[model samples]
Target chain A: MATTNDYLKGTKSVLPILTGLFPFGLIYGVSAVTSGIPKVQAIAMSFVVFAGAAQISIVNSFSSGISIITAVAIAGLINLRMAMYGASIADSIRSDRLLTRIFSSFLLTDQVYAVSITEKGKNMNTNIFKFYIGAALPIWLTWQAATIIGVFAGKTLPSWLSLEFAVPLTFLALLGPFLVKSHFAVSALTAGIVMVLTRNVPYNAGFFIAVLSGITAGFLIKNRKGDR
Target chain B: MNTSHLWAVIILSGIATFIIRFFFIQIKQAPLSGKVKELFSFIPPAVLSALVFGSVFENGLSSLTPRNPYLWASILAGITAVTSKNVLLTISTGMIFIWGWNYLY
Candidate 1:
């Protein structure tokens, strides 16, 4: 049976991620509304696409009068990391049922993936899939609600708050725990350097470049550390 | 965009996203060398860092100068992240700093 400590621990892990996600939800709602997408369509996309970055990309591209094909392409490219995330969780869960696997795939996101991986590594006996769902479902629901709130009330909210910064802040919080080690530190630095160097690449392809470069750097550092 | 075009975008994005996800999962059978595994591990931090920097900075084309309070706030946030090991504190402090700076300046 789950004890009070278990509940407390779960709440501790889940709340921060939800808080971080709140700003992005608000941004999506406001942006979608401002971009001329009907409220229902905007709300629907949040559930259907179920990705913050892709939704933002779609809205931004549409607002700029870019072709839908190009917009979708850009959004897809931005969210390619979800594939890695899905695969990572799939390996961990190792569920035989295809339906369970497919349903679980819908819950994969950056925050969910990071939290799940860390939790899986920490708790060997715990049910990894359940933990992932526990972490992910709240995030997904919170995102939808936040978007709707933003859509309806974003304009009424003061500009002084500048809810846009909330996304970066959330990511900062998510990434904070992972940087406890040197390998992670160097890798993050390398990624930042590469991203800055390739920042001008069109369609945000630079994000991919930064990810690849950082991964390569991290591998090298880890190997060198292992050798020592 | 028109309705047909929007549907096309959604369809294309869904397909592309599925393919990218499937690519990683399909590779589970392949044996990764130790060195390669080590290298791939860095991808998350590197990719995330780059994206973070890109988000904080404007125009994606400019160099990092300390002209903006956002950068200052981020530095403070980074420091807080390293010291306290608390995500909430780091983010809240960073946001407050940025908000206050924007308010004052």
Candidate 2:
């Protein structure tokens, strides 16, 4: 498998994406502290939860009156997207040791999923497990490290950076090339519209609904074209 | 919440998230069939669109207009991505656009 080479390649491919990530880590760290969350929990969540979006959202929504179950439910629902990522990459990384698959799955995130899928699309002959490990490790380290720094720094950051915008922008960059494909574009558009329509849906089930709508639209469109 | 309570939330949330990420991988088989694989390909666009649009409209539809720097910045960012096809450029453009917009008013 040339595990080392494949791993390094995975690392190299995802480094550029981290530019946007570093700021997010900082924001999460600073925001957690600013929100008057205990420093221990702030650090602990970053270390254990390891899911950036979920961690930040959970922290943002937290109040002394909020119950543990409600907090966990929020985290779980926000992270429900991971299930799809896990299922998608399962076949590719299934050849690895069970331990490796388990650990790599824990490290999965939007950036890692995006990177892994792009690598898969190129039909790279690389070892998928090693590549996934490579892709995931850097993000894990960068997030933990940046978060600690931000938490300790504890200074209110200037709002002008708009680093949060970088999140959607990064997704746009990753999603750009694919938009050229008609089916993908239609699917994306359909999903975006549904997302807007479902903004007020309870419990953020809107994500699930939009995803289902987009996938169905794309699949149907592709099949309809095939029958021609 | 107290420290113990916070810890409970953190640890339990972590465990729950890990299980979600691990569930499918733990049970998966290799060499997926064509139909399943094809369905998989649509996931990114759908998920990304859902996510991107989620953030884009984070302030709700009333904020969909240009006055919402996030909205306009994202639009310009989309253009940059489509034309430049460069992640760094696209991100820089988007963030910079928002910063500038916010700075002015």
Candidate No. with top TM-score: 1
Worst lDDT run of 10 residues, candidate 1 chain A, spans A1-10
Tens-place lDDT digits, model 1, residues A1-228: 343343234435788778767876876787677666778777877877888767766665565555766677657756766765665566775467766666667667788778878877887765666777677778878999998998897556666776556555555654666688887887788777777787777766776678777777776777777853
Candidate 2 Cα errors over 4 Å, as ranges:
A1-42, A51-101, A107-139, A160-174, A202-205, B1-13, B31-33, B85-88
C-alpha lDDT of all candidate models, in order: 0.69, 0.77
Candidate 2 chain A: 10-residue stretch with minimal lDDT: A57-66
DockQ of each: 0.43, 0.50
Model 2, B10-100: lDDT tens digits are: 8899999999888888884544577776776787777667767877887557767856777888888888877887766787788787778
TM-score of chain B of each: 0.65, 0.70
lDDT measured at residue A123 in model 1 versus the true structure, 0 to 100: 73
Candidate 2 DockQ vs. native: 0.50
Model 1 vs. true fold: TM: 0.69
CAPRI quality level assigned to candidate 1 from its DockQ score: acceptable
**B47-94 in candidate 1: lDDT tens per residue?**
457656766775554646777676788788878877887766786788
